[model samples]
Target: MKKFLKIIAIIVSLLGLHSCSNDLEMATVTKPEDGVFKLMSSADNVTLEKENADSQTAITFHWDKSWYGIDTPTNFTVQIDSIGGDFSEPVVSELIDNEKSYTHAELNYIALKFELDPDVEGQLKVRLKANLKYGVMPVYSDTKVISVTPFSTLNLKYAMPGALYIQGDAVATNWSYPIPDEQTMVQIDDHRFGLILNLVGGKNFAFITSSSGWSDPAYVAPDSTVPAEGGEFIPSGSNTTPAWGGTPMRSPADSGTYKIIIDFVEGTYSVEPEPSIMAVPDELYIIGDATPLGWSTGPSQKFTKVDDFTFAITIALTEGKYDFISALTWSDPAYKAKTGSEPLMGGNFIESGSNTVPAWGGSDITAPAPGTYTITVNFKSGTYVLSL
Candidate 1:
């Protein structure tokens, strides 16, 4: 029995040693920094012809094969950014199948997104990025600059929204986001939306695809220079453009009703004076503790129309607070009591009657020394003046 036990111990020891010898060894390999790769461009200056936008390639971008420590397929892409930019925020190109060619239409769309004016000289910084290992090591190539002149027409892959919504200080909610339902634009057709809005001049507004949140992509004025009325618009938000105003549509400086039309077909927008000022009362009046009406909101002191854009009224005002309203009702659009170019869009001013426990009202302008004063409001210039 002792001899059998000795034999069994020897066999177990031999099997354990063999298993350890067959196991694989492992170690960490530091990725090398030098001689990663280089990116090259076919042309330093490419003039994009509008005629070739559909059928021709603008330029060919290529890069050398990248070698990581391990034998793994690498993902390569080219990033585009404006010249002199930090490259901190860049638009990455889809380099599918490792192809580096870009069509004129694609390049032109990118140029427009970067705010490069068409038919004008612009510079784009291009660089190559390679992911050697997923979520781990990556390498970058030196940036190459290319001068390009994009065409006027831009064709991008941005999907159009089925319905459009607008909100801002100029429209409903008075610049508050998560806009109310009243501000949702009426769909005119497949790609057009027309809405007659009482816009307070001097306040800026923009359009959104979804009314549920502001984080969704929005549309803004095409460029930095915003027309007082309206003009062409472009896509905004981080998903669309890196840097565009959250609300770039500036209303007419004069507070009045305007018909705003947005055309997704042409990627354009227009704002014109509407015949009917449905949202805002045609005339404005004064009502408050300072006014003769005494906040009764029944028979307010009305302003005389000087022109389509101007109104004037000379009335007796005691020392107190007052505000301008378009109508006798407290719910119509009115001018805030503050001294600024901003006009209150919709007056949701809640009035608590004498029987109510809590009272609520809109802001009122303080009278600067009560007496008779002549007040003039100019919508075009977006200014109100009080002359004694």
Candidate 2:
């Protein structure tokens, strides 16, 4: 009887082991079924008010928590694309944390990035993507479509010298850069304005603010001699050129696009004609509190020209603030990143605008640490890189 009982016990133990193994296999083989998920919002159309344009909470998105029957961690990504645009390209793609919402400023910036016309209704498709851990396929919820209108109060203060015009005998038209051309010289600061123009040699030139005619005030040599560096512009009512026999400045002997630097504080200006065949300056430099130069405009670090439109530089940047300029003097034709990110080698190049005015047009580039870095800017491609 004892032997028979031992045999039965062995058989029972083996059968129990088989059943345990089957249970383990079943656990591993389990897969989650598709869950009914959807994205919801109270409002379908949101008109962004300028008052709430700041970095305030703009909108919130709610969705049903997906159930995979397991405690697998999941991630949610919010993607926004223009209407009729497929997921292939989304204007705004961001990962949402525990709180699923975006700020007004954030949305406004995204709208600007999407090139949405201001005050015009634009349609956008928003969708949520849920990713399951441990190799489960990512689940996508139904898209939520919404209409949004964007507005910007970013009124930039035009630096001193509100407007500038270039008129010369060498210029076929009386007004160069044309009337209302973006090239018109504007104040960069209280003291200076800078202009880059194609100047013809041996031609008489003069500075004027009004494009109506030569009746406006003009800048002439202090001694009434051409090519003099120091001069003062007469008041608007004065006919220095048209009535008082004022002298129109003389152009250099060689013809080319020249970078003209004017200092209102010192009442002085300098002309640097093109050094090569290119019309624009071949190099650009950085100046501000962040640079070692400390706005002294010196021995400014130089940018390397990779191509006609691409320029780069590498140097140790401090922890404060900085800006880029075409020359040493504080003036217009300065540049700032366009407030975004671009893929660089190890990191991203903060994007910037070309030849921004007022020196403070874009956010300052901050150094994550005091170290040497390479900064590259491409105007044609509209990209910039600051990498260590």
Candidate 3:
């Protein structure tokens, strides 16, 4: 009995020792040191453009995880405050993951509201720390400075005639000027003006003037010179002339001295109108197995009147056979390729045979292939006949 009791005591001691060893191993399991954090702030100065009264600026912070030997960061934290101040109680604290760079535009409105305070000026420091569990210590990025300026001032000087005029048509006169930077507004009289200059790296300025007030103007970096003619505004290519119109400025009749001020503020570009796509009558609509049978009624199909009878349709097509028919009025005698009881052969219609249709119909008539096809009509006192 004494020996059995001694044996049981030994077994209990061994079990306790094994359990303690397991506990120690679990506690020593450390997180990977590969986790690291970095922060980058764009733009040393933040110019809250005139239009951004709400004080919402798009600030971007970028960081890299490769430094820490991690595939990607699981999460990140952004702390922003007045320079050199602790961000533990920051004016703005943002938590983000899935992106190495975070844009302030996506922050909560309350955070933005706090940052927009007028008192928030000077070097705004943005601290970014990434959280990754692996090879190295949590890497921190260098402090970024964002100068919070209320407004940005842009100086406009006439490149050609040293003298600048507050009012009158600068476009009509020979004036050379630099393109306005985006977010800069040029004001003439009570109205705002836009740039119309068409030289390489050059911009033209035009502003609307009224008896009372003027509109605010903004300068956009000139991508290229404005074309001379054609109501359409496009970059000047080798063959096109540069012209400016469509945005008409009211002529100031009374000769009065006015001041022209150019202000630069952050602003958004106005949406441009979509190009028109219209089909002409007496024109053929073609489609094949790849195209819908009733493609004429499709949203992509449209007819626009270039003249009384001439119409145009712009379409994008893939390589395939297409079937088409003319949509001319049945009673129109000028375009009739066939008569009752007499089947009109393909030779009876006109074919251009690979020539692009002229902008307007006149003596120009293109021949067609050996099949029934529709002939384009001209409503302006002229008849268009299609002959093969």
Candidate 4:
């Protein structure tokens, strides 16, 4: 009778093990072969519109959950690369094991990284990356190609200029031609340029696309009027044979750090107080996925102060986003991605500061890719440059 009971217990244990094995199709009873999964997209080609970027989905990518040799929580990363580029150095967008979809802005941001011109269709490759726990190698799904037509971030209403500059007695320059770097206005967007400066109150200033000659277009104040705070302005075309006669902007009654945002799309400009008396802090640090020490709330990487208002650093960065902090914790006095620009990819050297913004909490600055980059920030001018 005892032997019969022992045999019955062994049979029950065997049945339980088999049930668990079936649940974990990838159970490592022996070294299991990697499981396969099919990846599919909702569209073969998509035309991206800026208006619909935030509210709509550009495309949806669904896939079967991948099976590694272990039964653990797996992470899925969607990668994108230029067509025929293989999977090397693709832009990464993370997804959970259960969720699958890509937003228009998210995909469009990746498409632009391939240098796809706005309003033009470009092709790219997509793949799924599955990561497992216990240090096992992550497996990847087969690749698929898609064509995308993306619109420019710049306003389509205005003729985009190569660059913009501010020249006048109110700024560092005295209406000089061939504008210097210091007086050059920071490109804010498709039709806006801005500058933060200690204007010489009561002096006059005007905007210029170039110092080429009298024919170079000039943006001047409307009717020689200066609003009590700030208001509308206009651009002078090159049609006038002689030099322009319209009034340039008059400096405010008070002299201090002020922000000027020139908007070509609306034919207006705005000026206001900025920085809220925040000077260049003595100690500045960068904290984010781009740095050696990632988003840990502990200490972060510091920058070498080149001068009173400038800071610079050369460091190796992964493809991630970051921002500057004055203290050890995420609090006030943080230098976020310049207002009106992508945190990760702000051109080779673009300046960010308009509307006195980048608010207290702004988007983190984006690193172009995984590489060694030099970041230089001029707090006086509220400008930053990222270069590889």
Candidate 5:
């Protein structure tokens, strides 16, 4: 009988141990509550007003609920920085009484200011993050970019004398001009300089000049007077005639100071078209500053060839006035002659007028008084034409 009692006691002890293990497992399965918080206002971006000497813009932040499901969070903090990174312990705000929202009244009253380095010239990243109790990790939102621009100054001056002009054929001349301390005089890129000269009714001449030193004597003029090294002269346009002016004759030995001279004869002058036009094929495509259409080169909206020497395109421009010129893509000779490099057509976007022709090339185009505009392609050319 004693042996039977021992077996029963062992079974009861075993059952009690199994029940305790099941209770511990149930407690482990239960999850802890999550911390609650949310932004009171819904705004993606904000631009604060400029602060005055004594007043600043104010902002408020409200939490969705108390931290850790508690009715009140006694200790709260706020921080700010111009850059986002793994910052050290940040400057914390003072702890306030138990509340769901905090008012930044101090910021509203004091002037808010920041300074940027002189070398930076792009958007700066600013970030704000927060921390709370209840095993919650720090929460962050999108960063903001603040534009920073550097300062600079520019100075301009004419590098050559204003009165300088071309004279005798192949004659040399010298010019004295002031230059900025920071800038240096270099050869003109296109071997040409801006010149203002009055051509006689029947006179033509060719001139040559260089940026190197000038050692040879200046070429002579048709008149008997000696030609000055830095002065103007008239050309006789005759190869056989000897130079009568006192101007010095140039030899192979002279290579220094650059020279330019003009020849005068009875003739009319004509402006030459760009050489690109000659190379364009009979069928060519043009666009850009040379065309009436504003600059755009996408596949959906591009210049299309209409014929051997014509093409068309369409664009939506702002209501205000604008300017454009003809520009070619790849080089082609045949069509270039008809199109030429000059601006082919131009016009205004008006509310109502000559619907066929909007405006003249180099003229202003008015926009609709105030409404959606349906701009049509209405430009034509003798050698070349364009359509919508």
Candidate 6:
């Protein structure tokens, strides 16, 4: 009986060991072979419209399932580049795990990064890369070429130019009176203005459209606090009411720095603490043969601060090509790529460095013609436009 019991215990131990081995089993991973992974979709031309930009998928990419020795998860990424160019400057878009497609809006946004001419068809090279895990070799599928038409979403109707100013008892020079020049507001659009000023708590203020003369089209706040962005205000008794009796906006608890934005179209105003006033750079220089100075930084055109965040330069640009750079070198920090509407336009001021440094060296901003143009750079808004 002792020997029988001992044999039974041995059998139980062997069965337990078998169960543990099965639980710890791992599948054999097979490294994907190069040719096994390929794009399954046809190279069809795609056209994306700016009107349907929201909630739209630009294009869907399909690919054959990657085959490794065992079934394991794989990451897929879609890369794009200018036609016939290497992938060195490839614009990487979608990165998904075990997914097969990307949306139109996603790809459309990526296409804009190329800065393709509006309403023009441009060829782009597309390819897919699949990887199993870190420290593992990634497999690249054959490149596919596709044609795409791109458009700009910027609407000229919503953008315009005009001048604005601050007034009221809260201001030092003009207490309850209008002083246009001393407190003139910088024009953002035909109706909007960006104003930076210091105020005394509990003091009341208002905005006057005129520089020298006071009048009816003045902006008044309804409450003690300034209006927020999209806050609406309609002047009451307009040309009929006393200017001082008109509604006035009062300062907040503590007086310090403030940024005010007034929009006339929507009849709104927003007041908030100035995050931190950006000191207007001592001097902003324009370089290139396009300028009358001809690439000389010293004789470079000087910028006049219209406000704490705006600068303006009115000069004759002789044609060729030009850019705004902090200094006289081909590197950054330089302002390039004048996009938006014709006549009035804007671009980004990219920081310094190579392709690795983001937003550097965009296309040169061209002059409408070989003549003088009034150029304004609003660092706060990240926009620069030329005016006649």
Compared with the true structure, the alpha-carbon lDDT of candidate 4 equals 0.69
**Count of clashing pairs, candidate 3:** 46
Which sections of candidate 1 miss by over 4 Å?
1-36, 69-71, 94-98, 154-388
lDDT of 4 by residue, 1-388 (tens): 9999999999999999999988777545232233356568999899998876887899988876635544567778888887856666688877666446677887788887676878899998888777765535677777788999988775533465677777788876676566676666666544667667667787888777775543356767766656735667655675643445567788888877687777677767777766543467887778888788887434337788987667788777897777777667664656775443654534212222444344354567777778866777766456566654
Candidate 2: residue pairs that collide: 337-352, 338-351, 338-352
Candidate 3 structure quality by residue, lDDT tens digits, 301-365:
43344553354344333333332335422112112221122122121112221231321211212
Order of the predicted models by lDDT, top scorer first: 4, 1, 6, 2, 3, 5
Error of 3 at 179 (Å): 51
Comparing 1 with 2 on lDDT, the higher-scoring candidate is: 1
TM-score (C-alpha) between model 3 and the true structure: 0.25
Q: Which ten residues in a row have the lowest lDDT in candidate 2?
A: 342-351
Quantify all predictions' global Cα lDDT against the true fold: 0.66, 0.59, 0.35, 0.69, 0.30, 0.61
**TM-score versus the correct structure, for each prediction:** 0.38, 0.42, 0.25, 0.49, 0.22, 0.37
Assess candidate 5 and give its TM-score to the true structure: 0.22
Which lDDT value does model 5 have at 20? 99
Compare the candidates by lDDT and give the number of the best one: 4
lDDT of 6 by residue, 243-352 (tens): 34447776665676566776656667777665333334545667777888776655447677676667788778776666776544544456665232223244333333
Which one wins by TM-score: 2 or 3? 2
Top of the candidates by TM-score: 4
* Candidate 6 C-alpha RMSD relative to the actual structure: 16.8
Worst 10 residues of 5 by lDDT: 181-190
Query: Per-residue lDDT for 91-171 in model 1, tens only?
Result: 787543455888898898888767677789899988877765464566677888899998777353344576677777877
lDDT score for candidate 3 against the true structure: 0.35
